[model samples]
Target: MGSLDELIRDLRRFDRRKEVTNALARKVREPVPPVRKKIRKRAIEVLPSSGGFGRWVSKLSITAAVKLQGRAAGIKLKGRRKGFPDKQPKVDLRRIDQGRAAAPSWGRRGEGDWHFQTVTPGFFTETTAEADEWRKAAVSAVDEALGVIRRG
Candidate 1:
């Protein structure tokens, strides 16, 4: 059996593992990437002026009143409508079951859709360069945390 002091130190290290893991998780989550690029500004039109005076208006009926109320007439402006990805995949660290960290792809697989790839381009796999980078970062983080715990 280990000494009481050694056991206490081990317990302290175990307790701190969650904090270190969570810190690493936050780091992993923040840079995963946004779901999609912002829609093109050209698709929508914005006017600096709220539509200056209309060509025809009766003198008795106030045009200024109409402006104050809202638009003089309902101008139906429509653009090309389409579906876009809305949810950004997250880095979920499951401690209870598998005890592994993962950032799910969220079922975004398309040959032509580039935006979906931004969120999760399969960086978790061993075959990719990104995976190697992730491994280095994760290892570095855990080592740094262990060093802190040892020093403390």
Candidate 2:
């Protein structure tokens, strides 16, 4: 029969090897963050005539809206600041006018106005699989450690 000291030594060696293997496996199965996706504007529109003036207004409105949204989303605006001798540096006001004109008598008799819409995109990932795997591995490791201790 094996000596008590030899048996204890063998059990300790087996437990150490199991722990190292479990740790390595856990590292290999670790989850990583997903990459961010690009946001794209879906659609844009401008009211009033479809003439050159309307086209210009539409372009301006779309540009303004996109810039505004980007700024609100924490994007840095491209420009230099202005400073007065007695005042702090300030951002220059950027403006885009949506041109409006009076409708022809043949149509409505009121002043024409412009309208537009904006959109923002985002990215995401599901963590169900990663969570499940982590839980299973953690439970298994704990159970194995407990078994080893109980046997000792």
Candidate 3:
């Protein structure tokens, strides 16, 4: 019931839709990262094992503080409760636990491909403030590494 011009326009619209759909399907079927190989090489160069500008920067260190409170104090003098001790015990100072940072490693491959495993150092602080300082240093290191990658 439509005019001839309107019918032609409808057909053209359908054809355009079909074309777009086919194009999208083909694109989806293609390999992703069109430049995967290049990216990989760049990533390697930007992230090296040691003695490189990106080496220290790419490492992430996260430090956590842990508070360890001493046990409860017992009652003073004897003849108290059955569970009570003769004297009140002194409480030990709370200690802080510090975390260490290391590089994240991808799995190793045959033929000279090496990986860097993450190594966490033992706690080194007795206070939360010291632990926080270590954590901030780690974050800064990671940020520096990201900056290097972006520049590349």
Residues 24-138 of candidate 2 have per-residue lDDT tens digits of 3443234211110100111123332343423323222111011111225211212122432333233221221112232234433233332322211110112222334444443
Q: Write the per-residue lDDT of candidate 3 for residues 1-152, one digit (tens) a residue.
A: 22323322343435343443334333332332222233233323433346341233222132122211224221111111111142212211111011222222343333344333333222112222233333343334334333333343
Model 2 TM-score, 2 decimals: 0.21
Candidate 1 lDDT over 16-82, as tens digits, reads 6566546644543332222111111111121111121011100011010001012332111111221
Q: All models: lDDT?
A: 0.28, 0.29, 0.28
CA shift at 118, candidate 1, in angstroms? Answer: 26
| Alpha-carbon deviation at 135 in model 1, angstroms | 1.5
Model with the higher lDDT, candidate 2 or 3: 2
Q: Compare candidates 1 and 3 on TM-score and give the better one.
A: 1
Candidate 2: residue 89 lDDT (0-100): 34
Candidate closest to the true structure, highest TM-score: 1
Candidate 2 colliding pairs, count: 0
TM-score per model over all chains: 0.27, 0.21, 0.20
Candidate 1 lDDT at 37 equals: 11
Better of 1 and 2 by lDDT: 2
In the predicted model 1, the residue pairs found to clash are none
Candidate 1 matches the true fold with a TM-score of 0.27
